[model samples]
Target chain A: MATTTVRLPRVLEPAVGAVREVTVSGATVQEALADLCAQHPTLTVRLFDEAGELRRHVLCIHNAQATRLTQPEPLADGDELAILPAVSGGSGDGRFEHRR
Target chain B: MTTLAVGTDKGAWLLHSDDQRSWAVDGPLFPGWGVTAFGRAADGTYLAATGSGWFGPGVHRSPDLHAWDQVAAGPAFGDSGPRLEQIWTFTTSLDGRVFCGVAEAGVFVSDDHGVTWEPLRAFNGHPTRAAWQPGAGGMCAHRVLLDGDRMWVAASAIGVFRSDDAGATFVPRNDGVEGAVPDGEPGIGYCVHAVVADPANADVIWRQDHKGVYRTDDGGDSWERIERGLPAGFGFPIARDDASGALFVVPLAADENRVPVDGRFAAWRSLDGGDSWSVAGKGWPDEPTYTSVLRGAIATDGDGGVYLGSTGGELWATADAGDTWQRLPGRYPRIATVALV
Candidate 1:
């Protein structure tokens, strides 16, 4: 049984907002994510899909580089994981502050 | 269950489900980018536009609605004239063509499924530079609707511009639309947000401007204020049912941009073509809910069903076009944008 740790960005830490870590064992990263998501149902919406497939826009980074090739795969022993959000916009708002 | 997408200033998410009682969600989306916009096409392809303040600009594309590919990454748009900088607003045409409305560079469009892009030559060269003043956030084309031969574009202070032949050209048309400051300053509107074009009617349009709700019957040629039953006509988003032209908007507090009195954070729908409205904030929080629904999000399904996710991390839905509202259980993901795609 291999175990891994996951870190979320500060902006995203509040999404789950509560108990941030769970221990899961899987041979591949997919199995590991499945285990993590299964342990924390509240983190479900922030993790997987209704069909059990990984949501495309969301990224799960194993170690430092992006996990583009190894999604839904098993995780190795002590591999660190990080979840990332998708930013969408163009240049314009930098000059003027958001006036609320 | 509706396959949902919620993008917040914090990040973006992809939600999926078939069992109405239960839904599956995934990702804070872009951790570094800070997602604000989500666009899903007909074939289930999803595009998330992120705004990485001081970091960089990027977009994520997911072919299967889950498990995305970092397909495009760069400075969102141009820095100054003819240059792209950090993107704040990303929109998609009905045909799934991607368009990014930048701050200084005017606008850019991607005909290659968001993988590549180009500039909007016309609006960028509108010849109305001096007259087209910048808004608080410099400016962006807040909302965009593509017509057969022209594109209807709305911004903060540049008023409105129309482009013919796929953003190849632009013309300004600002008549009947009015504005005022958030502090009731004399004549300060033009900070418009969401722009909706009736998929069925080319000329009819709806927008949630800075000060009021507006409708244009002659495309962007002219606009009329519609404020019959709204608590406050101004909001960040105005949603239209792609199938019915049913207009939906969240009312903000009149004096301040908070929840309107009576806990009516529910969405209002105008079936009589934007003339009158009714309350739909039943299950929505009643007080102190300052969830500023950002423009370009807050959408409805084909069933006249509306769904809104807020920066407040609350996901609320109405199965029957504001007849009633319900608060669904989900992450308080600071919904910067919402789509029932």
Candidate 2:
């Protein structure tokens, strides 16, 4: 398995000891997330939905490019996967604006 | 010292008071997350239900309210088609079973403290499931009341449902109530904001509905309007003081406005089982204050304390059964739920 680094958003730090990133081993994007969740189990619900699918608002970036969680793109030793909130539009007024 | 756990759209705060007048504020714990509800498990573990627009929902457990750790397996709807949006309320049975009412309108139970959860299929998959519609708050099973083997769940724009056989089956309990959506199924469109059962008699319950404030003596089989002192019956929360058998509700202008009547914020209290109501005691602001309290934002400490949090992020407390009111300091995000710990 290739060793990779998984970066989490600040809002999710509490679930993983307040760390910004973690090192995991996996062969693909999904496998790497599985490894990350295995290490920090609480992150599972935050990143994925009950159907085991990546949540609609969560985005996975691989090597500075947006990618799907189920993409089987092979991971290299230095590969980096970043979890970030998907930028979306909502109510223009801040009152009901969607969370970033 | 009496501590109040305030859950808001941003996080959670703990307000401590030694004499019910002066207070100390503790947090915005779980910063940036929407803390929806708070509950103490039968084992006394503090559970906070948190939701994120981007990351979905989660539950955190704490030995005390100070430090919390997220549960690995929280309440979820796995492969059930409907998305598990947010956990609205958590209710624990006398026998240690924990039940969670979640948005997307469903119920889940956990027998092992708050560690794991399983959905009650009978209630979740009712025959009226497809007809269930959401109010402006979105369809959510926001309230759950348990009376031994009988239980009630109130969902928005879907009225109330009762399970007489310990949640094995459920029946719609919206007779004599006006339907929010007129053209929908016969007994399915009544919008129920909140429900509080009489402490001494579970069969006697009070409800703050989209139509008006109502009370029922024969469980939920029938209801009668009970809005004497309330200016307008459009509001979100209805809380009952167990010790005094008093009921409380904050009436709003209308469903369209959703603010306090005439911009004056005051909670109406009923001492004689909701037969009539009056402005609950003094200390309300002299100026016009326009704010709304969500269904779960009002809570009573089994003794005589009643606390209310508003959508504007203000906190108010009444220490002597509404005889006197005080606005607690600190302005955070929109307050969602308040609980006395």
Candidate 3:
């Protein structure tokens, strides 16, 4: 098993005790995310849908490169995995604040 | 203490008052998420429904309204089923079963407070499932009302549904209501916005429809227009004060222009069980204030207290069941739902 770091955006920080980065061990991206969810069970719903697939609006990045969770790729120790939402913006009616 | 749990497009807030005269605000909890609905379990556990564009929908539980913990297993659909968009409303049954009304239009149930959930497939797969269409606000099951085995589920554009056998089956209850979509199936296209039933008699229910205001004494088998003093037939919310049996509605001009009639904002009240209506109370702004109240934005504390939040992010309260009003302090994101905790 490989130990890697997982990063999340601010919107998801609340589920992980307001922490942006977490460490887990897995051989592939899917396993790593599964491990992350096992530690913070609440993140399961936020990161994946009922079908056990990563939510379509969410993207997975590995070492600064876009990656798909479905296609399992071997992870190396100290590797970094980042989860981010798709870029979106529109006229604000004071309802939603755009965050980067 | 009187605390109003205010859910908004961005977060949730709790307004506390010792005597209902002076208020203190504490919130914006669950930051960056749309807190859509709030409810209390049979055991007094507070439940809040939250939705995110990227994270999907979830339910949070708390002993007090301030501290919340996300429930790992919330309401959800199957992999091939319609995507669960948002949790619109929650209704706790007499037997402690918690029912959740959700968008993409479906209902879910939780027996152990608000921790775990299972879809009510009978309602989700109603016989008219193929004919259900989205309203302007998206196809959403926004309200769930329960009276023993008789339950009502109201969805936008698709009208209201009644379940007589403990939710095992459901049928459309829009007999006397006008249809929103002309080409839709019989009894399936009525645009019902919100519904309030008589606490003493579940059959006697009031509805605020996209077409008009209506009431039914025969459990939705039929309906009659109740617009005697309403400015217009079109509006979004309908709330009832159980203590005084007073009914409330915020009438808008029409579906085409969803704003207060003539730029005036005031809640209309009917004292004789929705027979006749008039301006609810004093303290309404003298100047023109144009904004719409969402369906789930109005709530009653069951003891003469009524609270409402607006799309304009303002919160208003009535301690004496609409005899007078007071605007609470602080402006936040567009307010979506308010509950008396």
* Alpha carbon lDDT of each predicted model: 0.62, 0.85, 0.86
How good is the docking of model 3, by CAPRI class? acceptable
| Residue-level lDDT tens digits of model 1 in A1-100 | 6877776545433333344565677777777776676665434534443333344455677777677543355568878887665342222133123423
Q: Stretches of candidate 3 above 4 Å error?
A: A68-70, A89-100
Global local distance difference test of model 3: 0.86
lDDT tens digits, residue span B1-341, model 3: 88888888787888889998899989778887788899999999999988777787789998987778899888888888887878888899889999999878899999999999999988998989888888777788888989888889998769999999989989999988888998789889888889998889999999999889999999999999999988898988999999999899999998888899998898999999888999998988788889878888999988889888888899888989999998989887888888887
Instruction: Name the top TM-score candidate.
Output: 2
Cα lDDT of model 2 by residue, A1-100, tens digit: 8998888888785576678888999888888899999989998888887788877777899999988666588888888889987774111112112210
**What is model 2's DockQ versus the real complex?**
0.45
Interface RMSD computed for candidate 1 is what? 13.6
List, residue by residue over B15-42, the lDDT tens digit for candidate 2: 9999989999998798877788999899
In model 3 chain B, where is the ten-residue run with the lowest total lDDT? Answer: B133-142
i-RMS for every candidate (Å) is 13.6, 5.2, 6.3
Report the error of model 2 at residue B44, Å: 0.9
Candidate 1 docking classification:
incorrect
How far residue B149's Cα lies from its native spot in candidate 1, in Å, is 1.0
lDDT of 3 by residue, A1-100 (tens): 9999898888875566677888989999889999999999999988887788877677889998877676889999978899897664112221122110
